[model samples]
Target: MNNNIVYKNVNLKEFTSCKTGGPAKYFIQIDNVDDLINTLDSAKKEGINIFVLGGGSNVLINDNGFEGLVIKIQNKKLKVVPTMDDYFEIAVGAGWNLNNLIMELTQQSISCLEDLYGIPGTVGGSIRGNCGVTNFEIKDVVSKVYNLDWLRFNDYNFEIKTYNQNECGFGYRESIFKRKANIIWETNLVGKKCNETIIKEKIKNIMDKRLKNQPYEFPNSGSTFKNVNLNEFDSNIWNSENLLVVDCEHRQQVPAGWLIDQCGLKGFSINGVKISEKHANFIVNFDNAKSLDTFNLISFIKQKVFEKFGVHLELEIQLIGF
Candidate 1:
């Protein structure tokens, strides 16, 4: 890799949504698969560990920063082809900003992505995390995913693999990408052609709902923890705690935010970081907080919630370098 492409000691705070973190020891941005392959090969020769970053919305970088190479995906290629009557196949680059992609698709009368409006992050990051709201998940529209095998790259072997929707191993806030060393390059999504007016209305409704419920005015990663399955807890425990259960696609779930609020942690602060009073699930960087501050507060919240409810909250945000 050349100096023109690879940068040293690049600050990561500017890239992440939380606006807190140290720096990447080595950083490079790639807009094409060829560049990614070449970069991986170069990193392998240098014996450097690799971390792929997309829009940086759902991640927390440690205060000490990452010592390895951070590859930022910036590819934004998008193509839409009509596959059948009122049905279209959309091939999108992994790095495409998800919100922007949804808007563009809505302009073309695409329907499947309307509910995802106002969600931040890139296409690949959203798929890797299986990001969703209420009853709609990105997996519902994903037809196929194309990725590079990161594990093989370390062996100086460049291999590309494609996985159909079922093979992606998608679950709540997770996918095979989270468990395996797969670098998502592109994805194929299936959408139906709908009336543009109806699509826009759906987007507006979802956006309104998010604004009313989520604390969007502050700088924060979307959701701090994944909602727990209600079945995981005894029915008597739910009644004793007065835990509210909502039906999510036939399964009952208890919102993480509710648990945090029940523990009286909403608006709680440690240094400049504080849990959002508007939504307990969001820990916002209100006054130039340090990454360590957020980390400690998350630990505190977890301890308190577990002591009170006996439910351990799992982080929805990805922790990088920690």
Candidate 2:
């Protein structure tokens, strides 16, 4: 229960990847599970709302700032264990950077995460969104999730639990963690051993493809909208846009970027935010953008895409403080 971890009136823009948030009224860095529990307890006692921040890669904070406590998880611990057969279990702290973890696993000849190279955010944050690329997702290799069930916080309990893959409720960019407001502590990932040369080549290809298709040159929170599932909508309307649809593990999905691109909204801007010319799915903070600018652009994109194709686009990035 260390009490020296709090800070007041901290600028949140410095903590997010988009770099456009206002100051947090109260901020705290949690280094361990015990400290996080203590901090949450204190905030609860004060009736202050709580926001847990991870790598800050997939969230947009509002310009007005959060009124309550902002907890930044910083517990970084990594472990690797070789079990029977060709299986290797990797345990990563929730606060561990996801790209770093992938690199470390790839260097060790682990094949499970080689295709996910260059994805941003912390392991915990990635799991919250079930982050992935193409056909692979964090849920594929995640065997177990260690977390503090926040629902029990009111009962004076801080006991942590380990949930198996099924209990995690993993679906297209979703998990029970998002619904339960649970605090992810760490995750157990299992991967098969592969030739280091093959793993490196695959990683290289994935990284190159990402660089080519994504707008990484500007400050952005990655994809702004989720891909539309084909089964959910009238398939005949998408017949002409077949080139824009890609096969995902879940189903045939229409890329949100393609929808925005088809609406002629690429490079569209309002204030300082612009839908990236390089990738329509990204709304870049190219000119010192405000959260409101991004929000308005999002609404505009949704309206235009709907008007053009009669399909509504849902946001993938999480909004904070708004």
Candidate 3:
């Protein structure tokens, strides 16, 4: 038991956007990398699996709970450095709130990520998932990522390393962090000097669109499924309706919400969990929903979409403890 690390029981439901999950047997909040490494060494000796938790968005934890240690990141340092003529580099701690960072930068007349306004979660989680909205992704502005190599625990040794944007392996909702299990410590992003008014308007427009289309009033993860790639679908069927194409770095994409809506699944419910009326891709916790409720609902949605459209809907949210 490292004195610098505090461990206790905590309900995972309180730490997630869905607001429905069981307790974590052991939990600790980390403020610095040294303490995290020390605590990891201690936990390794105890033979407990470590689960890192972020801002509690874009995840669905199981009802049975995590039996190991849950590490909540809390570091929140931010720094801006001038790089070139009009572009600047900003370094942010992994635990900083995504929306707050965007707002802070925009207020300073630095606007590069205004398209991602109102998205929830922490910098670490966002980087891990490569979170994005229509036509914009976090990877576009990322300059570098700082992370601790934790997989080499045999020597009880660890080293902090900086990864360039290309080395991060960023794709649509994909990154090296997902595969390497490196502990993200900080991120450096590029931003350009812009008019404050233009940034504000962009934020306003994006937020308004989200409010109008998403189920923000209910407890839910942002999007349940990843958008389908057009190449995966039959051209004749998908093109019949003129499928909306998203310009991604890899390939053309279609909206999962559109597929669900076409299946007439809006407002569908299984117990307390329901497909959001405003957005078919979102499953809302309208009446004290359980983890199983969402799980069963997602299975049902996948089955129906597959049957109707001959397309598989891949999940976007990370499933914890299930």
Candidate 4:
């Protein structure tokens, strides 16, 4: 192991946005792909399980902690190349903060990512979950993604593989990275040039909407569940339930928050965790809360919503230790 980069029994609560979770038995932060390979090689030799953490915004960690090596990607390399047309490409590290990247793009008058202004977490995590709002998603701007097949570390094969946009297999709140053990190292995003004033206005409007709709005062992991596709339900069911249907990336969808609200789960609490009154989709840690408390509340919500609407709610946040 690279002793200089590795630490033992690091508290993971300090890393997560929710301010929960126990300590990581082993932890390392990698700033480059080469170092990540070397670290994975060492961990492989030790027979330790591997977990890659980015900005720690979209994860729930168990109180028992992770009994493995947690690798935090911190490579922040960035380069922008202008094309012949009114377009540009940005090559950024996986560890780059999503909000910071959007702000940088705004300063450069890039129009593609302005609508995604207020989202949290790293570029890698956003791509893994295909994070976005309304009609915009990380997949739309992604041109290419570079990652390492760490699951093959036992063979000492650490070659970097590049995937084109379609090969990413992006869907609603999902991507190939979510299914495969490959670790994203960097990505290339294509954007179009736009007026700086227009980009700023769009960002301001999106930020204002997020501040008004989301529960930001308490510690929480953004959205708890993924929205259901409208086609999954019968037309009569929608009319009978009086569910609100909205357009998402040209597809009709039902927001999970609205369903939770319909079930009367908003502002519900158990232990120190509570469903946010401001946003039914957010489960916030208003006080000191255990991971189990949040887990139980999530289970209860799924059951209630299922009983009422017969729709299964899928989690958006990654559960680590549990």
Quick one: best TM-score, which candidate?
A: 1
Better of 1 and 2 by lDDT: 1
Q: How does model 3 fare in lDDT?
A: 0.87
Structural RMSD, model 3:
2.2
lDDT per residue for candidate 1 within 39-94, as digits (tens), equals 88888888898988998999999988899999988878899999988899999999
Better of 2 and 4 by lDDT: 4
lDDT of 2 by residue, 148-187 (tens): 8775786455688999999999888899999977889898
RMSD of each: 1.9, 2.1, 2.2, 2.0
Q: State each model's CA lDDT, in order.
A: 0.88, 0.85, 0.87, 0.88
Q: Which ten residues in a row have the lowest lDDT in candidate 2?
A: 234-243
Cα lDDT for residue 129, candidate 2: 89
Give the alpha carbon lDDT tens digit for every residue of 124-223 in model 3.
9999999987678899999899987676754445777899999999888999899976789898999999999999988899999999999999999989
Stretches of model 4 off by over 4 angstroms after superposition:
1-4, 234-236
- Clash pairs detected, candidate 4: none
How do all the candidates rank in terms of lDDT, highest first? 1, 4, 3, 2
Give a tens-digit lDDT track for model 4, residues 127-152: 89999888888899999999887886
